[model samples]
Target chain A: MLEVKNLHVTVDGQPILKGLDLSVGAGEVHAIMGPNGSGKSTLAYVLAGREGYEVTEGSILYQGRDLLDLSPEERARDGIFLAFQYPVEIPGVGTNSFLKTAVNAVRKHRGERELDAMEFMKLMREKRDLLGVNEEMLRRSLNVGFSGGEKKRTEILQMALLDPKLAVLDETDSGLDIDALKIVAEGVNALRSPDRAMVLITHYQRLLNYIVPDKVHVLAAGCIAKSGGKELAHQLEKEGYGDLAGKTGAAA
Target chain B: MASETTTGLPYADRFAAIAATLPGQSVPWLRELREDSFARFAQLGLPTPRVEQWKYTNLHPLTKAGFEPAVVNGQGRGQIKALQPLSSLLPAEEPAHRLVFVNGLFRRDLSEIGALPEGVRLDGLGEALASEAESLAPMLGRAVRSGDNALLALNTALMADGCILRIGRGVSIDAPIHLVFVGAAEETALAFHPRNLIVAERDSRAVIFESHVASNGGVYWSNPVTEVTVEDGAEIQHYKFQDESLDAFHIALTEVEIGERGRYHSFVMTSGGRLSRQEIRAVLDGKGAECRLTGGYLARGKQHVDNTTEIVHAKPHTTSKEVYKGVLDEQGRAVFQGKIIVEKDAQKSDGHQLNRTLLLSDRAEIDTKPELEIYADDVKCSHGATAGELEESALFYLRARGIDETAARRMLIEAFLGDLGEDLASATVKAALQRRVSNWLAAI
Candidate 1:
């Protein structure tokens, strides 16, 4: 469902992702793990089409189409979702209204009839129950004064509502407590199905315990150092990236 | 009466022709007041950029426009031909006492005044002056002296028609009083000065909604001065919307004085006019008095909108709060000057003021000045101002959720302005103003 071929990205004229290649098939979940400043978030932002992440070389293909050619909103409407590592605190915008607008926009782009207020509320109630998100949180301004756990849970809620074909999770578990991590993982696990792919970018293997991934790759020096099955995550978690540091010619 | 020198008077020739036809000419006190005001205005002339208060805004365009007085054009009174489409800001179904004015003239045919409460005087200033001129003598211009501001003097000298509302002691009016002032296009550019006086007696309560709108395709100037007196224990919520034509100039000033334990709150939104300035000066005169001034403005194209406010705390334990937000796009320009003063006797006074603006384009500009002068050591007074473009992260967050770019920007701007209306007491006026903001966003 997603393919990145020798992708080299730069931000502020400094190269961050150099010759990075990765591929994920439909119904597969891949975990990309790296230490601090190893270009983990850079890869996520590049896939999400964020500005300032200039692609200096190579290309990204999603479902056999050039993903880099589409704008951020176009990528979103075409079933690509990016859960921001740090969700912006937007005061004055009601979370419920924002969610409704996003849901309607995506639905319209998919050739589906827009849901009325009543229908949308019904759907929101169901999703809220599944993710343990209460009505009060949605009534307040978007992520303003929200706790770290609440923000992460809301990101999951948005993912559930949009139901994107390819979901990019950027540090979703970085600030979450154990309870919030489980809730977020449960929400993500429920959405796992055929014809849908998800990329989990994390600095720790703690999240892999809740929702196991089919593959794991260690990113170092702006490129993937090793790719293996799920067991590689446990190995890296136990031994750290000390052994891979010599190959990448950088201190871990 | 045209002077020979350049500084003779800004509008001396024009004021000379319309002085005889002004309202309240027969009353001796009113006549002297007009003459004195005209002389003061002649001395001050037009405010130049050299003046400290008028540094950011230039009145050169207004003077060069060569606008004649509307009263002399015979358009202040009688029936107007194109009055059908000019509607009140309030909904038709809402119960309101409405007074309509066209070209600064009271239009009895267009005004819809319901049955006012007992002892409440709701009528035109022209009518009030014609009958029982003594009743309005002490209250008119009591909040602000004409000698303090040149534009106030100009308005006082050539005032023709406006709304005169007087609420008796302890009277509480449930319905809002609506004042609609429309400037209709004519053969030549016209200027009109409307004088408004609102007096809420001790313990009285009322709300007033004032709207200044202009008909399409007119180069007119609407110079209005409104004075409000909130007596001891009285409460008044004064709301105004200035939406003149895109080719027009709007210069308005409102002065309010609150007595012991009185409450005065106001919100003025400006989204129209080629060049406009809305200045408000409020004073808390007695102990425990309160004042809140909040508003939002939207400007685009070559429009220039200015909001200048001053709140003075004169008595101990008085409180004042102000918040103003604006959005400017294209080559639009805006100015916000907020001054807060805590006098020596105003010990324990609490005052806070905040002004934030969003500039949507590189060419859009905003000049904000927040002045805080506190002579009392025990008072808590602070002010802040901020101007910046929209947050790119916020915009990208909204668009990442499938919302289009335009929709995202609108949502953020709406949120920026909508937060200011959360603390408003009147829901009806809040909704009306919100609708106006939405309409302005749609146009931009």
Candidate 2:
């Protein structure tokens, strides 16, 4: 569903991602594990078309089309979703109202009928129950004064609502407890289908234990140094990234 | 009377020609008040940029325009009807008693005053002066003085017709009283002065909604003065909406006096007119009084809007709060000047003021000043002002969710102004104001 050829990226004139390449087929889930400064989050941001991230070289193709050419909003309308590491707090903008606007906008772009208030509420309630999110959190302003677990759960709720073709989870397990991690993992597992793909970016092997990936890739110094099965995660956890970096000639 | 060099005012000759035809000319007290106000206006003249109070706002446009007194009668009814939609900001659920005025003259035919309860009187100022002059003798020109502000002095001198509302002691009004002023100047550059008096007696409660709108094709000036007195244990809520013609000018002054244990709440919304200024001065006369003043303004396309307010705490155990916000775009300029004073012996007085502005364009400008003068050691007072562009991260967060750039911007701006709207007590009024804000956003 997605292909990256020698992806090289820079931010503020400093190189972050250098000659990174990866490929994922339909219905496949890939977990990219790396140490600090290994360009995992940079890859997610580049895929979502964030500004100030210069593409020094390389290209990204999604569903046989050049994805980097589209604007961030257009990419969103075309079914690309990025779960932020840190959610933004927009004061005074109700989360319910914002969700309705976003859902309607994407539905309109996809040539589908927009849902009314009642229909949208029904769908939202169903998802909230499935994810164990409270009703009051959905009624308040968008992530304003929210706890770390609540923020991460809200991002997962948005991913469930948008129903994107390709979902990029960026460090979704950084600040979550065991209960929150299970809820988020259950929500993601429910959305898995034959036509959907996901890329999980993480620093630890703990998250992969809940929702196992089809393939695991070790990212070192902006490149995929090793590719293996789910056991590769346990291998890295047992023998840390220090031995791997030396064997793979990784800068880190 | 027309000393051009010494007076420095260009409109003195025009004022002289219109003085003879002003309302209540037969009343000696009214005539003397006008004379005294004229002398004060002549001596003070128009405020210049050099003046400390009027530093950010310039009066050159008003000085250059040759504005004559608007014709009191024979204004086309069709023109007045055309401008009614602009003045209708009240929601349908809340029934209101409306008093319509055209060119500063009362229009009984267009006004819809439902059955008012006993001990309540609402009518035209001219009619009240002619019929019940004795009762109104002590109330007129009592709260507002004629020395410091030149525009207030001008409004007092040429005051023609406005609304007069009086509630008896302990009476409570369920419906809101609306005063809609429409200006239709089609022939010449015209100016009109409107003076409104609202008095809530001891333990009385009421709400007043005031709107100022103008017809499409006109260059006119609407100068209004309003005086409100809240007696002991009384409560009053005042909301003013200003949406004049694109080529017109508006200047208004509102003076309020709150007695012991009284409560006063006011909100102003400004979105139209080429140049506009609304000044409010409030005084807490007795102990344990509370007051809240809040407003929001949206300016664009070279428009200018200014809000100046002052609150005086005269007695102990008084509290006052003020919040004003603005959004400017396309070279639009906005000014906010707020001052709070805690007098001597006014112990335990608490006061707070905040002003915030959002600049949408590169050339837009905002000038804000929040001042506090405390003469008592036992009082708590604070003030703050802020101006900046919208947060880029917030914008991106919304845009990344499939919303376009323009829609994202509108959401952020609405959120910024919605914070102030949430403080309103009436749901109907809040919905109406939200609709108006949406309309303003759509227009831009």
Candidate 3:
């Protein structure tokens, strides 16, 4: 469902992602494990089409479409959702209203009918119930003064509402306690289906323990140094990137 | 359009033409007031960018056109018009007592004054100037000075007919008194000034709803000055809605005086007019009096709107709070100036002010100033101002779900203006303001 070919991205004229390549098919959950400054978040931003991130080389094809050529909104409507590591606090905009608008924007792009207020509320209630997010969060201005756990849950609620084709969870485990980590994992697990895919980016193996990954790719420097099964995550969590530094030595 | 001038123009002399049409009332106080106000008007002259209050908002586009006073080619008053909001959001039908004005003339036909309780007098300014000089002449110009602003000076210099509502002591006006001001369009560029005085007597309760709407006001100028007095223990709610024509210019000055234990609430909404300035000066004259002020502006196109307020706390235990938010789209410009003062001996006085702006386009602009002065040691006062574009992350969050950018933006703006709406004393007025905001946001 998602493909990145020689993706070289720069932010503020500084090289962040250098010729990075990765691929994930439908129903497959691939975890990109990297240490601090390994371009994990950069890869996620480049894939989701954030502004100011210059993709100088190669292509990102999502479901066989040129992702780089699409606008941020267009990429979103095309079923690319990014669960931000730090979800933005949008004052005055209600959480429910934001979700409904996004849902309809994507729905209209996909030739679907827009949901009215009542219909949208019902859909939102279902997601809130599934994700265990409180209704108070939905009523308040979008994420204004929202707690870390509430913000994370709000992000997951949006993901559940949007149901994008290629979901990129950018370190959803950060800032979340053990309980929040489990809830986020549960939300990700519920989204697993045959026709959809997700890319989980994390620094530790703790989130992997909850949402098992089908494949694990070790991102070193700016490129993927190795790709293996979920066992690679456990190994890295045990020995850290120190083991990769020695193994990929001279050749890297 | 006439050439723009800094000093004086032909329109300044047109005041005599308007004065000639008003009822002949040359009482000593009236003559003194007219002469003094005329002198003041001539002294300050037409407002220019040199004045601090009129700094960001220029009156050249308005004064450049030598329009006859709206009083000259005036159309008689007709039926009152509904607001721009959904009808369900407003109170059904006009209230019990209403005073109507057309081209600055009092229209008793469309007005309803019988709904007021006994001992209440809701009369026209012209009639009051002629008959009740004993009751109000002493306090008419005591509230505001036109010298501070040229348009206000213009209003005083050209004052013709308006409204003067008085509630008797210990009386409570259940139905709010509505004052409607509508300007008529004519061949020549016209100017208009409608002055009003609202007095809620001691221990009485009254509400004022001042609605200003003009259809093709002929690219003319509308200058209005309204003074409100809340006697000891009275409660007052004042609402001002301006939906003037795009070519018209609107300058409104409102001064409010609160007595001991009295409460005053004022909300201003600016949704129309080519260039509009709303000046609010609220004075807490007695101890334990409270004033709550809130307003919002929804501007689009190239319209320029300004909301300026000056609050004074002259007594102990007086509390004042002001909140204003606005959404500017296209090339619209919004300005906010707030000045708060706590006088000596006004111990335990508390005051706060906040002004925020949301710019929807790169071309849109906002200038905000929040000033505070405290001479009392026990006073607590503060003010805040902020202006910026819409939050991009919020937009992306909404669009990613399916809401089009337009709808998302509308929702955000509505949310931004929510708290201010909820502060309205009347539910209908709040909903009406919300509807206007929603319509403007939808169009934007």
The candidate that wins on TM-score is 1
Regions more than 4 Å wrong, model 2: A242-252, B1-9, B71-84, B91-94, B130-134
Error of 1 at B36 (Å): 1.6
Candidate 3 regions exceeding 4 Å error are: A116-122, A243-252, B1-7, B14-18, B72-96, B145-153
Highest DockQ scorer? 1
Q: List the residue pairs that clash in candidate 2.
A: none
* Tens digit per residue, CA lDDT, model 2, A213-243: 9999998877888999999999999988886
Model 3, B158-274: lDDT tens digits are 677788877889998888777777766666666668888888889998777877776444576778888888889998898878888778788888988998998999988889888
User: Residue A167 error for model 3, in Å?
Assistant: 1.3
lDDT of every predicted structure (CA atoms): 0.88, 0.86, 0.80
Model 2, B1-444: lDDT tens digits are 354433444557656566766766678887777888888777777788888888999877876666766643323222465334654457534689988888787888888899888999899886776556667778887787536787788778888778999899999999999888887877677778888998999999999998777756577888889999999999999998888887888988899999999999999999878999999999998899999999989999999999999999999999999999989999999999999999997899999999999999999999998888899999989899999999888887887889988899999999998888878997777876888789888865
Best by lDDT: 1
Model 1 chain B: ten consecutive residues of lowest lDDT: B1-10
Residue A85, model 2: Cα distance from true site in angstroms: 0.7
Question: In model 1, how well does chain A match by TM-score?
Answer: 0.98
Q: What is candidate 1's lDDT per residue for A89-181, written digit by digit as tens? A: 999999999999999999999999999999999999999999899999999999998999899999999999999999999999989989999
Model 2's alpha-carbon lDDT is 0.86
RMSD of each: 1.9, 2.5, 3.1
